[model samples]
Target chain A: MNDYHNRRGFLKKSAITTLASLVGTKIMFAENIPARVTPLPLLSDSVDGKDPEMTVLSDRPMNMEAPAHLLDDPVTPINKMFIRNNGLPPVKESIDRSAWTLTIDGESVKQKRTYTISELKQRFKPHTYQLVLECGGNGRSGYYPPASGNQWSQGAVHCAAWTGIRLKDILADVGLKDNAVYIGYYGKDIHLSRDAKKVVISRGVPIKKALEDETLIAWAVNGDDIPLFHGAPLRLVIGGWPASVSGKWLHTISVRNIVHDGPKMGGSSYRVPVIPVQPGEKVEETEENFRIIESMPVKSLITHPKSGAVLSSNRSLSVRGHAWAGDLEVTEVNVSIDYGCTWQKANLSAPKNRLAWQQWSAKIDFPQNGYYEIWVKATDSKGVSQPMVMPQWNPKGYLNNACHRIAVKVVV
Target chain B: MNVRRVTLAVAAFFVIAMGITCVSDLRNDQTTTDTTATTSLVDTLNYDPHSGLVVDTTLGLVVANCSGCHSTELIRKSRFTRDGWIAKIRWMQKEQNLWDLGKNEKSILDYLEKYYSPSSLDARAQMRREPLDDIQWYDYQ
Candidate 1:
């Protein structure tokens, strides 16, 4: 009798569990989350190796721009340099220095040649130059009709000392054909899709720009191995142009007879409208209507005392900053405390090298205690000066070299 | 045999009564299984608090389509017109290999235009700082 009761109880519980499970499964599985969720910002120090102050724009293909104040150092430290990655950096284990090699080949090469990093180092003389690299969209936030991409503020520029062999030396060794018009570079960075065939980004400069003495196939910055975030094993450092022209994780460079038609070379990638358009005007862009941006415009940043600095009326305020013109030198930098009513010239210093940024300083005394804005404008070797307002609007919002202003409060 | 049959019938009735009681206990945690019920489960159930995306009917579709390539922060920080959004979509499709939205394009565009389009706060007249007449200066040693 007991055995019969036990069997009957077991059957009843099993039936109930089955009914409950059917109801519960519907509730639990109702939300369908896709497999490829957005990447979370999960950079531990070891992974990114960037200062905590750097603002991250993207994580998957990590891009971070430095803050204006932290960039006060005359020579930008490796930690403070901005990182712009177009694709996933080669895996740490795969970046074996011994196995790394750079190949020079394309339609315009007399003969294709490959060189190991050690061989290149031994064969060619090493040179160092402090070059200023500014992103084309450095002041993009100033645009009224917002631009797309990494909404960089004023910190995408850095002047760092890079030690490497001159790219011109390598081109000379490779014996470029007379027809070589442009040189496009290839990197080892993996595409986001992990597709082996697709290139993330491959941009190049004209052969004339490539042959400049300052253009370097750099392996180190500030006397140290290039930070992994800034493309350590090897990179091309073409200063004074858009930093993108300086490809990172560089593995191969191709000399092309025609303008190199790489992934980002065509379209309006780095090109501005040949005829300037009004803000918010849409144009059907074509080759004739747009031109590739070469030298970036004049720009300045006030890095001393920082914005929101508090000052005493009795003491004279000392201000300092760094300024750069794309391919020209900063001839003058003026600071205005009382709006643009009057301008006071600051003491300016020459660049350490040809394409390096110049430093400027000034001392000012306040008559009364209140809030004031210190605006700094830089003029390049050419008569061109930074505009007080946003410059001509472009579709991609490149080169918004408006005067940088900082707020200060004075106490009596 | 007759006695055994009688016992089986009585046991079956008792077991059915117990099963109904067990089902009632299981239902205490759930409000209702009906999906169409008017009570908004969006705040409590359907929302992702991390991205702070406006929870609407089309949010799941947006996340599935857009978040796969970039963080929702990129979407959140950007303000654009309907045309601008369309241009970006076209650019991505052309350059970044974004798959065609197909039949779902209208809904996605509608959601983006409603939430992501630029507003009057963008006017430079409003964003400019007020002239520094009113002053309360802090004492700095």
Candidate 2:
């Protein structure tokens, strides 16, 4: 035993001691630490009320994404909602929902205002909207030389009906100064290192985005207490933007005179290159070269008749999916079965509300009995369309709103 | 039952073997009992199976430093060159308050680059090269 310990060069006892001290409340003794750590659970295993089919990328600072096939529902249920966390969630048992308080303050705020959860619900009129939240790095796996973060496919996006008070109403109550340029949020999630001073992730949007009618300080998702995993007591629900901007477990909102310089606001955290770079080129992360991603790009997903569907030669396939453009409306969606060689427009539905994803469907008749790929493309109100291939590769691989294609085998 | 007889026979054989070994070790004055207890504790305490870290020379360092805050899946899924790994470490130090690894940095980086470096041969890279051709195709209703 002594020899084994001696052979190991970097088993500094301080690492364990620090962790023990940090989680001292939960784990009292060193022996309490499990002797043998178990192997990674099978992906089929589910926890925290999430569906078993959802992919588990990492569990420590839990990050999970739903598979594309499972995302067919228009209003993504709490179980199906993708979870992307920068740090561990606050302990659910310890949270006092009624006593939860949200403070609005910053350099540009005329007056600092604090409201208990109950007070905010009672004083302000409630509104609900089906908001689409997508990770900035959604579809990151398609980037060549793959990105450094979670290898999310297309599952890191969802549309859920959020019920909460308008953020504009709260800002009006607090009174913003003329100099207000941005709004930054702070959440109660504990940092990974358990450093009290180190925030897990604090990001915010511009003041204009904050004042939009759909921007909300939401506490309910699909008309229930926000699940603990999704941010329980309170959270910000800014639609049509990177979900990171909709900070979860929200506790404080700061009206800033300058652009929000919170933890993830700087660097290449959620920013893309200002100019397109070669696929393999390395670019230094700088304010001059990289700019924060604002409204997301035009994107769509074919949710029904999931990829790799097998069908009889005579059967016509009915394809349906959802499309959304950040801060813009999806004007049209087209489907092609001949590998983009020929195209036909699909019937597109109006969004339930602004910033909500629009649904579309089309019946595709196969010309022969072989293999085929169904491709869907969406065009936004600004005349911007989804790229056939991935957008120019940035260093961080932020946005890849390429047309989503699925496969089908037509058997004779 | 015959099963009970077989179980008793196996148990008796192990008991006899252990008795002989213990008696021989006692005569040899080798502290065999102490060694057995130590071995059991080491087996239970030393390794974490769930971390998903490839066992290597720097496994101790990687576990001590990296797994404390996040799962090793983050490392397993990521592919980076040596400089990229260094940049990640620096980011953690600057933003995450990761303590200076000092001399152990080289070993950790070496282990990571050896095992986790970007390669076109990885499963994910292959996935990019070809859409999943092996997935079980289901009948469309």
Winning model by TM-score:
2
What candidate 1 gets wrong by more than 4 Å, as runs, is A1-47, A313-315, B1-47, B125-141
Candidate 1's clash total is 0
- In model 2, what are the clashing residue pairs, if there are any? none
DockQ of each model vs. true complex: 0.07, 0.17
DockQ of the two-chain complex in candidate 1 = 0.07
Categorize the docking of model 2. incorrect
Q: Give the per-residue lDDT of model 1 (tens digit) for A220-335.
A: 99998877767768999999999989988889999999888888787787888999898767767788888888999998999986676677646568889999999899999999
Chain A TM-score for each candidate, in the given order? 0.88, 0.89
Q: Evaluate all candidate structures by whole-model CA lDDT and list the values in order.
A: 0.73, 0.76
* Residue pairs in candidate 1 whose N, alpha carbon or C atoms collide under 3 angstroms: none
Candidate 2 residues A1-412, lDDT tens each?
Answer: 1111111212224434544454343323333222211111222233456764576667777888887878888899888899999998898887899889999999999989999999999999999999999999998877876677888888899999999999999999989899999999999999998998888888999999999999999999999999877888899999998999999899999999999999999988899888888776888878998899999999999999878799964558889989999999999999998867889999999999999999899998887888888889999999999877767787877888988888899995
lDDT of 2: 0.76
lDDT (Cα) of model 1: 0.73
